[model samples]
Target: MTIRTAVMAALLGAALTGSAVAQSGGDVGGVWQTQAGDANVRVSKCGTQLCGVIVSLRDKIDPRTGQPAIDDKNPDPKLATRSMIGVHLFFGMKPTGANTWSGQIYNADDGKYYASNVALMGPGTLKVEGCVGALCGGENWSRVSR
Candidate 1:
């Protein structure tokens, strides 16, 4: 290709890459809003490990009881009364890479614990995965406010 054509192609490539990078953030820490927009979670350092906590909910009150929503699905009876807000989604997650961690995560939807991994895909994206035996599934969370 001619030099002028090559330069145009390179600029186009750079522009596309820049756009993707703009959409993807570079840092992991921040409050992230889930895909469903039902809740906001703050992932931060809890001592030596990173932990995620439910900070806000779209529906904070339980419709059935007209009170605050709770972790009714928790395995431990003692924890069942705890509110959904401030509940730990994943704790004891040890860093496995510069922006990844491996640990167990609580699934309120199923009220069970599963092997889980958290990775920073980009500044604006976080990849969270949970596994039951060999089956694994995950969703991407987006940064709301840094």
Candidate 2:
């Protein structure tokens, strides 16, 4: 009877430990960089998995023209589109594995949709690869302190 009790306790402990590991995705919370810019991203579970959301944007300047990144594709040409600020920008994301994620990425600049994937290169860096149909582009972004 004593041996049976010990075995049961051990089994219960193992199951509990596994549950905890699955809940935590090996340290996945912090300011992660993306191809667009440094974004304050919150990594958390959605339903039974994990995802990230953009909380901030860094260097609102457009790297290509050294000017402000503006949304010029709005049908309402009279709407004074701001440099940065919009919803449905990064609607949702899903975790793929160790620092990798896949989801829809909204391009505020051109008002286009692209299938996007993100790879956290390090605590201070990340790689964002995005594709539209057969065309794709990628870039590395550095994390912001905030």
Candidate 3:
């Protein structure tokens, strides 16, 4: 093949690969949870952007007290709400740059929405942050072992 043709082909291939990598988002697809709070979340793509949702509930057990974690905020007085499962407890995310995404975050505890951002910390970890107006908080999620 001509040198020009070969160069063009190589450039085209590189562009395609870059685009795919950007869309796939390195390693953001998986289950993630926090160490300190109840932020167990699963990351997935909503349309073209990455998003997270609560899919499982950690068994109700307190680490320090070895007692069952009780849901003190449950609206129903008698119903046990310590662990919530299968809630669409997050919002969609869009790519902002390399390994960074901006989106909306939903708090399952209170059903509130806020500004959200996420970044891949490692191969199986994602650092997720959410902001309430101006103040922000974040959590580190380890990839769930499936």
Candidate 4:
């Protein structure tokens, strides 16, 4: 083949490959329901990395106060009074592989941060795993909105 033709073919091949890789990664920006179906989080790009924030809760009212639930469990005393809704629970998640990301997830229930891995199981499902020391647990979250 002529040198000009070969160069054109290489450029075309690279473009196609890049497009395929981007598509395979699958966008995780959306609202997802936790496995227990008690909470919903919205995932979106926060600067260069991805972050997830609590958007809704099945039990919205604080049992003790009969008011909206607050982040009473937060380690920071000042932040403890902040509402749980719209709290960023996951942060610094960057794509690690096709459909996978690594980050930190904050567990409001325990008032702790854990090493977390997130993966898109399918177009509509996400698997979120958090590890503390040697113990790890994961839950499948369904996409609630895009």
Indicate which candidate wins on lDDT.
Answer: 4
Using TM-score, rank the candidates from best to worst.
4, 1, 3, 2
Per-residue lDDT of model 1, residues 1-146, tens digit only: 99999999999988666544433434566899988888899988665467899999999898989999999888889999999989889967876655677789989887898999888888789899999999999999989987
- Give the alpha carbon lDDT tens digit for every residue of 1-146 in model 4: 99999999999988666545534567888999999998999987665466899999999998899999998988899999999998998877766666677789999988889999988888799999999887989999999999
Worst 10 residues of 3 by lDDT: 79-88
Q: What is the lDDT of residue 84 in candidate 4?
A: 91
lDDT (Cα) of model 3: 0.69
The residue pairs found clashing in candidate 1 are 25-122, 25-123, 25-124, 26-123
- Give the best candidate by TM-score: 4
TM-score for candidate 2? 0.54
lDDT, candidates in the order shown: 0.83, 0.61, 0.69, 0.85
**TM-score, model 1 to reference:** 0.77
For model 2, residues 1-146, the per-residue Cα lDDT tens digits are 69999999998887666545544544445555555555555444565444555556686676876876555665456543654533344335556555666777766557666788766676666676778877878887666543
Would you estimate the TM-scores of all the predictions?
Answer: 0.77, 0.54, 0.63, 0.81
List RMSD in Å for every model shown: 10.4, 7.9, 7.7, 5.9
Runs in model 3 lying further than 4 Å from the true structure? 1-21, 37-39, 60-83
**Better by lDDT, candidate 3 or 2:** 3
- Model 3 clash pairs are none
Error of 1 at 30 (Å): 1.4
Q: List the residue pairs that clash in candidate 4.
A: none
Candidate 1 weakest lDDT stretch, 10 residues: 18-27
